[model samples]
Target: MGFCNSCGRPIVKEDYGTNKDGSLNDEFCCDCYQNGEYTEPDITLEEMIVRKTKEMMAKNDRLPETHATAITATFIPGLKRWNPEFQDDYKTL
Candidate 1:
């Protein structure tokens, strides 16, 4: 199964976001996208990494902070929403 390109959440059918025409946007999650718009348009990639790392630590206390941060650093940049060109195109979309 794939993950949400924005938040790294597992991409289950119910978690999918809607396109402008109300079709499923397979690349994003409902939390990150709604009605073809980013929920937090101004959030930067660094902010997202920091936020997700904190979330990981909160969800699993046993997870080390360094490990969470490392994972976030590696994963977030590669996600479609955070990719350099994709981020630019997303704003236009």
Candidate 2:
């Protein structure tokens, strides 16, 4: 029941991506990572936040845009893929 590192969606086994060696990549979801590569490698943190906020609004009509933005802003940075140190350590991964 862990969440996706990219979009914050609940992760199931099928949602996990494959690693370089074809093993499961537990940290990221299939939409964010495939074949050990980022689907949107050039996307900035702010862009991800904006995109996900829209999706959140669409998925839950009661969730206001402002609240979605706030939630994404607060949550994304803590995900493994968005962590500054983690990014710095594995810029290519």
Candidate 3:
């Protein structure tokens, strides 16, 4: 018996079909094929609260949400590296 990673349902080998990557998986399950009720990406409570707070404050101030959201986001080390547009405009090479 194999358990579906996405749905937690116990599936028999005969019920499962091979995925393109060759993993034995079910053909009919929503999680198996991403048909419905997808799981959200894992986020910590701290991250969740910060995102909401920034969005809320931005709304009250009549400014775009990214203002506060960017501040919180830039503190996350490697995440800042991913945003090339935020790089210092004056720095050359």
Candidate maximizing lDDT: 1
Kindly list the per-residue Cα lDDT of model 3 for residues 1-93, writing each as its tens digit.
Answer: 654443333567664645556565453233343323223446443554475456557567865566656644444322312235645641552
RMSD of 3: 15.2
In candidate 2, what residue range of length 10 has the lowest lDDT sum? Answer: 84-93
lDDT of 2 at 13: 91
lDDT of 3: 0.46
Point to the candidate with the largest TM-score. 1
RMSD of each: 2.4, 2.3, 15.2
> Which residue ranges in model 3 land beyond 4 Å of their true spot?
1-39, 62-93
Per-candidate Cα lDDT values, in order, are: 0.89, 0.85, 0.46
Q: Over 4 Å off in model 1, which ranges? A: 85-93
Tell me which of candidates 2 and 3 scores higher on lDDT: 2
lDDT of 1 by residue, 1-93 (tens): 578898887898888988889999889899999998989999998999999999999999999999999999999999998788676876786
The better-scoring model by lDDT among 1 and 2 is 1
